[model samples]
Target: MTVTERVRPGVDAGRLMEHITALAAIGATPDGGVTRLAFSPEDVEGRAYVARLMAEAGLAVRVDPAGNLIGTRPGIDPGAATLVLGSHIDTVVNGGAYDGAYGVLAAIEVARTLAERGVRLACGLAVVAFCDEEGGHGTMGMLGAHGFAGALPPGIAKVLDERGVPVGDLLAAVGGDAERLPEAAWAPGDIAAYLELHVEQGDVLERRGVPIGVVESIAGRVNVSVTVEGVAGHAGTTSMDHRSDALVAAARVVLAVRAIAAEEGVVLRATTGTCSVGPGMWNVIPGRVRLGVEFRDVSADRLDAALARLAGAAGEIAAADGVTVTVEPGARTTPVACDPRLRDLVAGAARERGLDCHHLPSGAGHDAQIVARVAPIGMIFVPSEGGISHAPGEHTAPHHLVWGADVLLSAVLRFDEAPVARG
Candidate 1:
C-alpha cells in the first residue's frame, strides 16, 4: 500500500507556523480567535499578504471577479488542466487559525517547496484562496466554490448583515466590483482535480491518539425553522389545561427532534440552536415561540427519514397543545464523498511515510464539498489539539503540521503520475 515516490526535504515547520501566526494577528479577537469577514478591509489586506508570498514562490497570481485569489505554477504542458489546491480565507466570528487558513497556507508551502527544487509535474498547480466560506453575515457559506462550480454567482445581489451592509456593498468596500462578479466562475473542463488540507475540527483524532485523518466524506446538512403559535393568557389565574402554552410546545419539539436524531444512528446529528418565548417570561404563558433546527448525516436517505419523523413528532405535539406550527425549510445540501482514487492515493502516501492513518468522515462542512460537484476532490486532515477549533486555544503541534504537508506532497506526486480520468 506504500506509494514509493521520490521524497524531497519536508517543508520547514517554522516557516509554516510563521505564516499562520502572522496572518492570525491581523484580525485577532479579544479571545484569540480571528474575525476577518469576507470582502472586508481585513480580508483585503490579508489576501494581499498571501498574494505577495505566492509571488515570492514564483507563482503567477490573479484576483478573479469574485475577489478570489488564485496563484498558478505553470508546468511543462500548458494545454493540460490544472491541479487545484485551495480553501477559504474567511473565518467565523472569533475562529481559530487552523480552520480555513491551514489549507491555503499548506498550499503555499507546497508550492514553495516545489519551486525551490525546480520540480515540474505534468499538470499545473493552482493555489486558491476562496472567499466567504464562513458566511458570518449572509448565511451563504462557500460562495466562492459555489460560483466556480456554476451553481450560483459569488456576489449575492441583496444580502445584508445585522448592521445593514449589503453583501454586494461589502464586496465593493473590498475592491470587488459587483458588475464583474460573473467572471469569477470556472468552466467544468478547466480543473484537473482539487485537494484541500484542513483541521479535523473535532476531537476525534486527538481522542483516538492519531496524528492524521483522511476524510472519506463530508456530511450533508438540513436546516429548518419552526414557529409555534398559541393563545396568550395571564399566568396568575389561567388554569394549566385552559392555557395554551407555546413554550411547552416548542420544548417538546426540541426533544422530539433530538429523539429522531438519536434513533437515526451515530452518523445523524441534530441541534435546536435558537428558541424564544414572547413577552415577560416571569409569569405569563407565552403566546408565541420560535426555534431553529438543523440535521446532518452522511446518508441522504437517513437524513430524509429523520426529517420526516421530526416533522411528524412536531405536528403531533403541537396538535395536542392546541398550537399551530409553521415549518420553513432553510437549506438542504448533499453530503459529498471524496474521490475514491484520490483517497487511496492519500492513504498510500501516508503509509509510504510510515505514518499511522485511517479513513474518517467529516462531520463539519467544508469548501471541498462544493468543489466535489465539478472535480475529483480529496482532503487531508491533521489532529486538532484537544479536538478544539474555532477558538484561540485551538492548536496542532508543528511536527504534525509538517507531517500532514509531507503526506500531501507525496499524494500530489503520485496523482501527477496517474492517467487522466475522463468519463
Candidate 2:
C-alpha cells in the first residue's frame, strides 16, 4: 500500500507535537532537560497527565498494580488478543525530552486518530506507559514490565529507595498496590504483539539520512560490580615499588574492559561508568576502589565470552597488584530479536510513506525487551539529532517526529487488520 492510500484522514501532527511539548513541561529543568525519575512527584504528575490524555482520547484507562499505565480500546471482536503499543515515560536525571515520552504520546495519537475516524478492528488496541524503566532508587530497571511479564523477583516489595522507603510504599504513593504486583502479570497469550516507537538514541539513521529504523534486535546487558582492596598509606611514605594501590588495579581493569570489548567485535559494548576511590586524598595512596562494569552485545555467546575474559583479567590484575578483587554480577538481560513478520510490517509502513528506513540493532535496553517475554515484539526508531540521548541535547525534528508517528499509526492499523501470533 502506498503512503497516500493508507494515510489516516485526521492524524494531527500539531496535536502530537502539542502533547510532547506539554509533557516536556512537567519535569522541565532550567537547563532544558527533564528530571522525572521513576516514582518521583514529577513522574506521578506526568503519568496522571497521560492518564487524562488517554481518557480524553476515549479509552478506558487503568493503573496496574506495578504502576504501569494501561489504556484499552475495545475492538470489533472484543475477545481477540490485544495489540499493545507504548514506551515508558520516566526519564533519567536531566534526560532529553524525546527518549521515552515520544513513543507514549505517539501511541496515544494513534488511538486518537483511530477513534476520531470511528475505526475499530478485529483486535483490541492498548497503549501502556511502563513505570521505572530508568531504574531510579537503585532498583533493577524495567520494573513495571518485569512485573507484567511475571518476571519480577520476589522480595521486590522490600527493595528500598534512597529515602529508605520500600518499593511497596512507593507504589502505594503512586496509586498502585505493590502487594498485588504479581497479579499484574498478563498471561503469555493475552497480547498478540507489542510495539514501541523511540528515538534512535544514536546517529545511525541521521548519518544515513533515514527517518525510520526497524530494530532487528535489542542488545543483552550484564552489569558487574567490582571492588579492589589494597593497603592505604601516605603517598610520601609508600614508595611506588612497595605500594599495592587499589586505584591502580581498578584502572588496569578499566583499560582491560575497553580492550576486551574492542577485541570482541563492533557489536560488543563495555563500559565502566562509575568508579570511586576511598579516602581520596592528594597525599594518600588509595586504599579501596569500586567500579561498575557493564557489558552489552547482541550475541549471548559473545557476551559470555567477553565476561569470562573480563573475570580472568580482573583476577590476573588482582594477583599482580597484590589486591583482593571481587566481581559481583548484577542484572543480566538476554538479547531480544523482533518478530520477523512485524519487522516487515514496520518496513512496509515506512515504504508506503516513502520514508527511508534502515534495519538496526538497539544498543540501549528498552522495556520492549522485557515485554518480549510475553508477546512477539517490534520496535521503530526515529533519528536522534547528533546521536544525543539521556541529556538535554536529545532531539528529533518536529517533522521527523510526525513522520515516525505516521509510520507507527500505519503499522498499528496493519496489525489490527491481521495480527501476528503472540509467541
Candidate 3:
C-alpha cells in the first residue's frame, strides 16, 4: 500500500517546540545558545527532564551501562525486535538549540503521540538519548554510541567528565555502571533498525530550498597530528638561504591539505584547523610547529590514499626546508552507508507529506555511524539556517523542525508495518 493510504500518527508541533524550548533553557547561554557538556550537572538535569517526559509518554525508561538513556514502548508481540529512534542531547559548548536536541525530543513526541492516540504496531519502539556525541577531547568523542555498539575505545578509562569527575563516578551519577559498560552492546537482531532525525548542520538543504535530506552516508575520518622541528635563530641575523624555519614548513603542509581537498577528481576532504608555533617572538625564528590535520570521505580507500599523499607531501616540504616532521595519526572511523530500504522509507515519507527532499552525504560524523555497525541505520535531516552548527548562531526554522518530526512519525509507522519486523 502507498504511504498516504496507510494509517499514521501525527506529531504535535506545539508540544514538540515546547519540549525544545524547555530543554534549551536548561543550559541556556546568555547569548541564546546552550552548553550542556556530557555528564555535566546541567546535562544530568536535562537528562532527568527527558526521563520525566519519557515516563509521561507511557514508556518504561532506563539508562544503559554506557549512560545511554532508553525508553521503550512495547509492541503487540512481546518478543518483536525493536525499532530504535534517537540522537544525542549533549551539545558542543555554546551550541544552538537544534543540532541533536530535536531528534531525541521528537522521538519522545512520537511515542507520546502513539500512546495518546492509542496507536499500536507489531514492532516495539525504543527512544534513546545518547551521551557525549559532540565532545572535543581526544578519544572521548562518540563515547556512548561506540559503547552501545560494543566497541568502546580503551582510552576512555583515562578520560574525565566535563566536571572533572572520573568515568566511574560519572556513570554512577546517571545510574550506569562503568564496570559493566561492555554489557551495553546488544546482541545482533535485538534492534531491527535505527533511525535518527537531525539538523542538516550544513547549507545543502537550505541552499537547495529543500526541507528534508535523506542521508546517503556518513564520512569516514582520519586525523593526524604533525610536529615540525627546526633550529631557532635570530630572524634578522639569520641568512634566509641557510635558516630552517618550522613555521614555513608547517605552512606548506597546511597549503597541501587545502590543495588536496580542492584539487580536481579528489573526493576526500582535508583540513588543518589547529596549529601551534613555539618561541613566539617577532625577532626569533620558530623552532617547532604542531599541526592537527584531518581527512574525510565516504570511501575508506580514498581516505587512505589522501592521507598517504599528505604524508608524502609533508616529508617533501620538510626536506626542502631542512626540517624534520612527524605525523601522528588520531581517532579513525569508517564511513557508514544508510540502509537502502530505510532511506527510501524516509524519502517516501517526505514525498507523502509534500515536503521537498534532497539526498546528500553527511560530511560531519554522527552516532548513527557507530550504530550502523549493529543495525540498519537511516537519518533524516532538516535545513540549518546559513549552514551553521556547533555554534551559537546555528538554527533551523520552526516549520522545518516540525516537518522533520512529522516525517519521522510517518517513517516509524511505515517501519512497523513492513513484513520484516518479526522477531
Query: Which one wins on lDDT?
Result: 2
Writing each residue's lDDT as its tens digit, candidate 3 over 1-423 gives: 545554353688899999999999999999988998887788899999999999999999999998899999889998888899999899888988998888999999988987887778688899999887886332377778988899886756546755566776766777778888889897668888999999988999998999999999999998889999998999999999988999999999898888888973354578998999989788999999999999989999888788778889888998799999998888788998988889899998898788889999999999999998888899999999999998889888899999899899889888887733322
Alpha-carbon RMSD of each model: 2.2, 1.8, 2.1
Model 2 alpha-carbon miss at residue 286, Å: 1.7
What TM-score does structure 1 among the candidates reach?
0.94
**lDDT values, one for every candidate:** 0.82, 0.90, 0.86
Which ranges in model 1 have alpha carbons more than 4 Å from their true place? 1-5, 153-155, 264-267, 419-422
Which pairs of residues collide in candidate 1?
none
Steric clash count of candidate 3: 0
lDDT order of candidates, best first? Answer: 2, 3, 1
Candidate 2, 1-423: lDDT as tens digits? 543555655369999999999999999999999999999999999999999999988889999999899999888887898899999999999999999899999999989888887777679889999988998877778989998799999898898877798999878877779779878898887898999999999999999999999999999988889999999999998888999999999999999889887765533789999999988999999999999999999888877887788889999999999998898888789999999999999999888788889999999999999999999999999999999999999999999999999999889877876678754
Clashing pairs in 2: 3-352
Cα-based lDDT at residue 144, candidate 1: 72
Model 3's alpha-carbon lDDT is 0.86
Q: Pairing residues by index, what is the TM-score of model 2?
A: 0.96
